[model samples]
Target: MAIATFGLTNIHRRVDITEGGVLGMVLLLDHHFGIPPWALTTVLDAACYLLGWKVLGRDFLIRSGVATLCGAIFFRLWDATGPLLPNLSAQPLLAALLGGAFVGVGVGMVVRQGGSSGGDDALALVIAQKTGWRLSRAYLFTDLTVLGLSLTYIAPLRIVWSLVTVTVSSLLIDFVKTVGHSENRQKA
Candidate 1:
């Protein structure tokens, strides 16, 4: 999730596009209200963690905390090594696809392990638990809400691309989760 966050931000910077999760809200806040992404994300994620603790129990909190910490560390590490990485943004479409895939797989793996990487993932879990909806549907609902809010700040064309990224990521996350579940069932 952290590596994918880096890739998403890289694409956003290169192509003037935005993301569609909590990260997108962070970026929008930064753009429109002069808030810093790191600060906002920390506060928001902390609130989400607290909520998860209350609703999902202690195990979820602990695992999520670990995943969140790892994500933060990896994001910073990737930022520091940014110059060493090749520029993937040269092709915006490919960058978006790859970024979406990375995010999907990363988030999927974390969730499959009973952890969450951010507020978005926690929210999706909560929604799924409460409503009996699929995790992907929950993600789609929340992500689309954020993306819609983002239209106030982002260009229409960029928003279109962001939608594509979110859609692909959402589907892939479901795919990964389904496959993991099937494998675990097989093992059992």
Candidate 2:
């Protein structure tokens, strides 16, 4: 959560790059409605958690709760602070790549533990279970939906850059999970 927060504060916001899934929607709503991202994140995350609990079961809820709380708290803590790292607005590609790495590694760690750092995971899992879609397909569907909506506020070129970040993050997330799972299996 801290890494993801740092990426957003130091790079994404500076580069004017938007993300997908629930975070993207939070950014969109915050931009148009003057709602704080933390508030939006909490409400939206809680809503997804509720739905996920109903669909996925209590174990899922328990697993996600901690990371969800940490995410909200971390976002709140990181909320008002200025970027601690150098601004990467002038180098958008680098910003995008770094943003992807931060999110990928951070989220992958949570996911490997059978937890979620964001509502996107629960939502995607719910969608996958209910609709019989693969988890990857569900995630892609949600990401594309949010990215498409973001087009209203974000530029086409910027969205393309966002695609790059998403692609990198997705691949890295899978890589991390796969590698971690393999290592665990080998250890066992």
Candidate 3:
């Protein structure tokens, strides 16, 4: 969670390479409405978690709640420090790769533990459970939806890189889930 948020605050935000799903929505709202992402993130995450709790049950809620709380705290702590990573505005492609790897590993670990790092994960989990789609496919669906909407404000070129980032991260998340869990062996 920390690594993912660091990449988001440091690399993605600085490089103008947005992601898909909840964080992407947060960025979108921030860009268009001048709302602080930290506040919006909390509200959005809580809403999605409530939806997820109704669908996924109590244990899932408890686990995901802890992870989400930790993720939020870490995000604020990192945000307060400002972006310490080297500027990547000139190298969007590299930023995309690094950002994807960080988020993939971080969120993947949480999902592997039967939890979610953010609202997107909870929503994706619900989507997968409800639709019988693989988790990665669910992630791609949600991500692409947000990325498509991002076309309204963000450049098409940046969306191209975001697509790459989401794809890599989605694949890696599934990869991590499949590594040690036979029940989660569905391939990306």
Q: Candidates' TM-scores? A: 0.83, 0.78, 0.85
- How many clashing residue pairs, candidate 2? 0
Report the lDDT tens digits of candidate 1 across residue range 119-149: 8888777877777777778788988998899
**Candidate 2 displacement at residue 42 in angstroms:** 4.1
Per-residue lDDT of model 2, residues 15-119, tens digit only: 888788898999999988999999998899889888888987887788788877777777777767766778888888898899888877777666666677778
User: How do these models rank on TM-score, best leading?
Assistant: 3, 1, 2
Which parts of model 2 have CA positions greater than 4 angstroms off? 29-43, 76-82, 129-136, 180-188
Using TM-score as the measure, name the better of candidate 1 and candidate 2. Answer: 1
Query: In candidate 3, how many Å is residue 97 off?
Result: 0.7
State which candidate has the highest TM-score: 3
Indicate whether candidate 1 or candidate 3 has the larger TM-score.
Answer: 3
**Sort by lDDT, top down from the best:** 3, 2, 1
| Model 3 spans with C-alpha error above 4 angstroms | 27-43, 76-84
For candidate 2, report its TM-score. 0.78
Instruction: Pick the lDDT winner.
Output: 3
Which parts of model 1 have CA positions greater than 4 angstroms off? 1-6, 9-16, 83-86, 180-188
lDDT by residue (1-188, candidate 3, tens digit) is 78777877788778878779998899888989999999998898888888888998888789987887788798899889987989987888898998888888888888888888879999998898888777889999999999998998988998999998898889788778668767575544
